[model samples]
Target: MTPRNLLAAGLFCGLAVACANPQAELAAHEHYETTGGSMKLALIPPAEQDDDGRYLNLDPEGSHGSIATRLGFFGRRILTPFRAGAGAAEHTTEAQVSIEAADSVQWVGHSTLLVSMHGLHFLTDPIWSNTPSPTPPFGPSRFVPPGLALQDLPYIDFILVSHNHYDHLDVPTLKKLAKQFPDTPFVVPKDNAALLNKHGVNNTIELNWGEQTQIGNLTISCLPAQHWSKRGIGDTRQALWSSWSVTSPNKRFYFGGDSAYFSGYKLIGDALGPFDLVALPIGAYSPRDMMQGSHMNPEEAIKAALDLRATRVLPIHYGTFDLSDEPLDEPLARFETALQTMTNNLSALILKIGERHAF
Candidate 1:
């Protein structure tokens, strides 16, 4: 098939799927349904989930335009937009970070983040790829390189994967990490084991929504997110998607792997929250109508932080990749405006790429 046709929305589809009655789909997939149009899909053996032929969300939405129309609009835009000092790395430190640090966060560009608390290190949706797609020379290109190279990383105890999107779950980067860490644990969502297995990853743990696992002093909780997943054609929702909570005796951290505005933040906070820091996405939200179902805008992100009762907020998933119509710096500008409207005592740590935010 031509590349344009290949750009079809895996999650958003034509009337055959997208237009299916939400109530009917929700009714059919009752087990996955939860409050506020979110899902808690069972992350079982890949075969079990695939055996059903497809995964369904309780309340789903697709953009009004077809795949071709959206593709053409995006194609006209260059790989990276014109932004002054778009990818400057002046403040980055390549110093080997230790898990023993009391608390620190290293933004490795885009949504890739390395966080440390009470001497344990965890990374979220780590990606070091030049492009956010399987097809190279197409798709969104990176505006900046990763803050720390794979080799520069300190000993990583756990890797937290949110979903299987190319940007969030780059297989090429995963292969390098698996080779380097060998036994480091990879905690992924369901339906993604086969890919990691093929990549020679031996220590992979898959979890469903609401499940929790312990690694050292960290309590890793797999939680629900308002998002969809599809790495390729015919695989929409074949894998589960999630956000995560990493809690230590001294502090709690929440990484919003990828999500739009939804009530789940409050639910997550209620279950296990009042976090020290929240790493939430505030980019790729232009043409808001097209991205609303899957991505959060700056204002919504602030509201989510409030809902979660996070004391300190770190804005991520912006300024690294030109994924939408918004300017490279627009997310930050909007974040400032949104923060002012909020009536709460909080802090926004808008770090430059490769900069460290100490706790």
Candidate 2:
């Protein structure tokens, strides 16, 4: 189906497939909701629970994983090579990343990127643990190390965390960063301040969609994305999910933390257009029926980039961990295929896990 068709179908099915949430359950937090009570959801008017325009509507009746599917994903992981070695070979060093420009980006690993703009160094969804899970060294092992070690970073002015997911918001890393950079600000979604505080990480600023804050010379606006937030049970949807637009004096940039394909991209672009560069996720989309709601495949990522009117793109969220059944390289392969089919020449900057690009 065309992207538009898929979106329409999604709205139809997604609206019908409602997740349950009693008012009492969300009494404490007005910003939280959930669909089918699985992944917590938030409603943004004009793009709220009813706004089907660009929402990814996975079928309510689609094939959801049973015990068998869970086992199957595990089996596939064990059997598939998933480019574990090639990703390991791409490890970048701090020396290589020191070649800086006024604006530059380095793909540290999955969903973790170092964006240097406005004369300030910022990291998006920073995670340097050996895995995406809380119990690092015990969960998915990290074959690819970060391009720049925590110590290697020149100095982080602030950190932008998309959600509370382990991959995106590693509290251990946060604690370390907080201890090391005592003055660095940690920007996150609402209701997430306590989480950081628990790790002894202070200076956190929480934002809701449409809220903007000034950090140094740049203006950072917290925008919505089609996604959910949770570190464990009962905390789902308590914290908001978001995309961010960081506008500097001369350049505007975007960081798509983690999300499924949604119309918010167009809305974001409409509201904040012509991004000099956008860091978008492009992996973990196998079993589309299940992941469609929160994860975007390569094609979907491509569409998202176009929707955001992004001038250049850096694809992340793959090659770090084998989160899904698809091969690690499959996203790029599919991205190539989808890009070829596009009539408009799109400038997608594909970087090695540890590589750097100056914009």
Candidate 3:
């Protein structure tokens, strides 16, 4: 095989083997009831796994595009050169972040948000890396730096990580957080704690779908998301993926780690929603055949917000990193367009990187 063909073959092998993880010992599907009151509204079902113990989406068929199609997508990415700094520059704010601010959320760039609510602080899918690639310097570069510098972060009560994808589950950033805040709990999906522990994040709380855990006065629930996870070679679907619902005495918030459009949103809404604010992904969705299974476009994100019965929508996961074929500004434009068509009272809480909005 020629060098290009050889590269493609190697990648194909890697993707093929990225199916089952031998380290995973997933339990049989069952409902878990926690002392935490987050489950008071609904009983979430256990996430399903295949015979190989690999996690499966509620609608597994066609969730991940075919292997051949994936290969073609990668081939195009490899052959088509991206100009350095092709996208518009990101606007950032350097305002002082108050640690005691209550009921506020700040966008820290793609999937990362610093949230302060009900007397506690929370962070979601915290990635500060310049690139999402495991092997850096060769992948899509981050056009924007982290909205809030690490040094400016407040004392976090807990951190929620959605999955093992490099972008969402950034180990380097996690390690930094772990080192800085050794006592903070890092909540992650089943089969993902071991990886964090191996990397020195000792205080990890593993939750399967349907499980709820309590921290202070807050109740955190592991909710369903239509997504898959793969961080290392041969580990696809080895670890579960999830969105999160954090509930307090006066308000509730939903942080969608990453997901494609699915009916689960309505279920979640009917159960523990009409949320005060729902943060949903609205980027990295293009080449529908390649992304439709995992990433939701801006319009789908709008639909998801409505399905969740969100009082307000916080659009995230866009304009920070180059993860798809769409223009950097497209997601927001489409999101705004979709917003114009909304006849309901649901409002959008659009934040520039580093910008904050009160809930």
True-vs-predicted CA distance for residue 272, candidate 1, Å:
0.7
Better of 1 and 2 by TM-score: 1
Would you list the C-alpha lDDT of every candidate in the order shown?
0.70, 0.68, 0.78
lDDT tens digits by residue: candidate 2, 1-359: 45554333323222111100011111111233423332122223322332432222222223434656544554444333333545332565535535454578888888888888767778898888775554333334466777777887767777899877777888778888888777778888767789998878878887777666667767777777777665654554566668888888899899998888887788788777788888888887776655677778888888998988988777888777656656667888778788779637468788877788888
Candidate 3 lDDT for residue 146: 80
User: For model 1, how does the per-residue alpha-carbon lDDT over 1-359 read when each residue is reduced to its tens digit?
Assistant: 36564453222222011110111110111223333333332331111233565554333554535666555545543323343446332346555445364588888898899887766666888888886665555556576878878897777777899888778888888888888776578888766777888878767888777666777756777777877777656777788888888887888899998788877788777767689999999987766666777789999999999888999888888887656677778888888888888746778888777877676
Which parts of model 3 have CA positions greater than 4 angstroms off?
A: 1-38, 41-43, 63-69, 79-81, 84-89, 94-99
Tens digit per residue, CA lDDT, model 3, 1-359: 36655464335322311111112222222335543442453546778888999998876545446778667666545432253545533666757446465689988898999988777888999989875655554445677778888987877878999988777888889999998877788989999999999998988888888777877767788999998887656787899999999998999999998888898899899888789999999887766777888889888998999899999999888888766667888889889989889636789999888887778
TM-score: the better of candidates 2 and 3: 3
TM-score of candidate 1 on Cα atoms, chains taken together: 0.81
Candidate 3, pairs of clashing residues: none
* Global local distance difference test of model 1: 0.70
Give the per-residue Cα lDDT of candidate 1 at 347. 85
Give every collision pair in model 2. 19-35, 19-36, 54-263
Give one clash count per candidate, in the order shown: 0, 3, 0
